[model samples]
Target: MQVTNQPIDAIHEEVFADTTSGIGPELNLINPQPESCRQISAESPVLSNIELAKLKNIPDFEAATIPMLYKVADGGAGLKQALDAIFAAADKYIAEGKCILILSDRGITKDMAAVPALLAGAGMHHHLIKNGTRLRASIIIESAEPREVHHMALLLGYGVSGINPYLAFESLEHMCADGMLDISFEKAAENYISACTHGIAKILSKMGISTVQSYRGAQIFEAIGISSAVIEEYFTGTPSRLEGIGLDEIAKEVAMRHEPAFAEQNIDPFSYESGSHYQWRNGGEQHMLNPETIVKLQQACKTGDYKLFKAFSKQLRGSAFANQNLRSMLTFTP
Candidate 1:
């Protein structure tokens, strides 16, 4: 409701509030060791533990995946330790029929992405039948085709999850940098909604209560740490964001229609790039995209003539823009 009194985080807490019966602490999924799940305080712009934990609980809805963000003091040892901790928690979830998706953060390499995928595939039965199909792992690499990443998700049988708004926004920024308009108006509006939804989801996930509709609505660029004035201004064009409306109101707007718009396909990237580690909002892990196939995303990002940068960003793989050349190209000022 009254978002003025509510800070962005507070509103998110309200929107994404976890109604799922005390899942985190009860599950004890985080590491017991001080190193594992060790709380770190970040300065402005960086998300907090409370906020990161909010997302930690999000994979429960359908087959969801998220990248793991860990801080390591040692050179590569930290990576191994973090993976160990992740697998430990992953082992439990897989044993229990719950599928856990892992995307490694910066410092994680293509090799790392492969390791977890191999482990999860092999242990799918033993760790699952004995426990449940709880853990699954992936590494995000560079690809132009958004579907390349989507297809991988399908192969894993996780259905498609929209980390779309995040990608769309990145794409928008990428377009802006290039001073070229490749996105369409319809796509822009869609991205606006998604960006708003993602922003709200991060806030709710921080508070531990994000839902499908809420997450989708929170991705609006205005919702993610931007000023309220800006958020309201952007939503002016949307039918959903009426004059007196707030996020909770917006959440209600898209809550009922829950299925993904397009059918999942077996799209994989032909020309892919690898990175040591790439990152995204909500601490997403390194992702794979096909720069060569990115043309497929033209339709997805190009919504009519509007070129909704925000929506198009969502269609991109989380790591598609992490490349210096790509990021520079996207953000390049004409």
Candidate 2:
């Protein structure tokens, strides 16, 4: 029921996809007037119209806490632990007859690393599906991992019913404190939720689907660099045209954040590393088009040398940085 898609106006209106079943339109938990951000929470951020009011209801919401620290530094141990916990939570939910499973990565300390919520969520979803427990409980994630529309879409696409972007709300609060936002925190949060829900609706609309329920567990995404084994075991049925990294690579990537956060000697800046995937940096996220690649291409063109051009092309295919894209991994099929 998209009364209005405009951000501010939409917040005032009760515009949500159908949640309640066998209920009349008027009784579908519609909020006509302005309200607080009480609707926003770790569980059912996209409110299901089945409200879980009061803190006492937490007993029904089984929590699966993800840890940051592990026995190994490369984040393999930590990630493995989290994955095991998620799978275990699936079983626990089934055994206990629970309605909701909340996977949270909020156990933050000086010595902890986060298992990527997307990876964790998708893995759990697939695991539960394999074991015939996907519908046992609705998956709700309360974490700082998701902040953008892409994240939310991917989460829902892979089988997440609810998401509470806690960190984003904190950031919005900071912005409001610094006078960056002219509206109240509740209004900012409402606008943010509205934007995310609207963005999700647009994505689904592109797929010619009107409801989020149809998009849920659809796995309508293709992997570029992720390996076949990972897709088969974790992200089953998702297409991967050019398989790339596997578990080891994933662990190393997680370690990139984990190690820094848990390091004995704090990073001098105490900030996340800047990625150079967009523009080249001394030692940053790799990009296919960099100074060396550009220089090689320029030299090859200037001298009209096929060998130089071959070298340039070779660099594009051979170099680790260049292989980040699927195009670099493509080969001629005879």
On TM-score, the leading prediction is 2
Which residue ranges in model 2 land beyond 4 Å of their true spot? 1-74, 262-334
- lDDT for residue 112 in candidate 1, whole number 0-100: 29
lDDT string, candidate 1, 1-334, tens digits = 1123233453524543421111121122453554323322211111222333444465542223334433322323443454456556655544454433333232343222222232222222233224433223221211112222222222122211222223344565666566666666446535554444444344544433344322222232222222343233332212232224433333232232111212155435332323234433233343444442345456546655335444455545345555433343355457
- Candidate 1 deviant stretches above 4 angstroms: 1-85, 92-102, 106-126, 133-172, 182-334
TM-score (all chains, Cα) for each model: 0.25, 0.69
Give lDDT per model, in order.
0.34, 0.66
The residue-by-residue lDDT of candidate 2 on 133-247, one tens digit each, is 6655567667787888888889888987777788888888888998999998878888887778777767666665555666777877988878898888778899887777876
Clash number for every model? Answer: 69, 1
